[model samples]
Target: MPGKSLSERIADFGRRLAVEAHAAWLAARDPRTPWPARLLALAVAAYALSPIDLVPDFIPVLGWIDDLILVPAGLILVRRLIPRALWSEFHAVAAAASKHPSSRAGMAMVLLAWAAILYIVYWSVRVAPVH
Candidate 1:
């Protein structure tokens, strides 16, 4: 097999991070999970999935701070909180999810949903009764 390009590897890593965050989200809700671990996992997953960032991505070097610093740090903290046995299971699930090809159709659907929402807002503003 040919060696993967740098971009491919980076994309794979990003997928893995998303997968692991999702897995942790699931694990956090389990009854057996410790409260502290659950809290950390939930926070980490929420931060990772949130569209709004602590530092907006358009802000040059500062924009990347949350992504480069906070996320990895949160993931590491969550890992420490999880018990060894459960961590292994979460790792396995994350690894499996990361290996599958991403769905372009799903991406399109999300984009369409956002467009529809924006259009609705625009139309509402245009047609609203004058105050």
Candidate 2:
């Protein structure tokens, strides 16, 4: 395939990351998984998705550092929790999903719609007079 647009690449990476994170979380929570590992994965996911952050995204390169740290850390914690067999199974699934082709056009359309909605909301807020 030809070179992908930045947005498409980002979206594809985001989707794959989400898939891997979800698998890791599930494996960590399996009954066969150790309680300590499960708890750690839960905590990590919560922190990663939380609105509050140690470093805000507006801070240049540092903004994304949390993501780099959190994701791998969470996976490591999960691996420690789950059995080797189960983890191997989940890893296979995640690998398959990553190899699957992503629909760039569909993702772009969804992003555009979201942007349009946000723009409309911003326009309305700006034009509305304070009571």
Candidate 3:
């Protein structure tokens, strides 16, 4: 396809955003994260990556609603698990990542490169001549 159809492009963008949110959740939960908030981060990351969901992604508009809900809910759950001071520190880091352009650009470039490499490998394998 010369360019993705509008719906395809939108779907791709939504998926990317969901992945980014998941990454942010993981970073927030790192053990090195303050003792207080570490568990919260872990819980959020686990839930985000988990196969189980409040609403499965296969559904129409309702599917992604889980992404919107789970992330914040996980954060709240983490906050309850940890002390306020530590949660503040992790939140600060999350805010910094959200503001950082280089990190976002790097992630996008890496994903694009990975996609390109996978496409090339698949194409080569499919078109390879028989011995």
Q: lDDT tens string, model 2, 1-131?
A: 88999999888876766666656655545677677866775555445434445556789989788777766677676777777888787667766663433334334544666678889999999999999
What's the candidate order when arranged by decreasing lDDT?
1, 2, 3
What overall lDDT goes with each candidate model? 0.74, 0.64, 0.58
- 1 versus 3: better TM-score goes to: 1
Candidate 3 Cα lDDT to native:
0.58
What are the runs in model 2 whose C-alpha is more than 4 Å off? 88-131
Which candidate tops lDDT? 1
The residue-by-residue lDDT of candidate 3 on 1-131, one tens digit each, is 59889899878865544454454464564665565465555455555544455455789989877676656566556667656665566556544564422234334444666678889999999999989
What is the C-alpha lDDT profile of model 1 across 21-84, one tens digit per residue? Answer: 7767766777778999988887777667665565568999998877777787888888888888
The lowest-lDDT stretch of 10 consecutive residues in candidate 2 is 98-107
TM-score: the better of candidates 2 and 3: 2
What's the TM-score of every candidate structure? Answer: 0.65, 0.52, 0.39
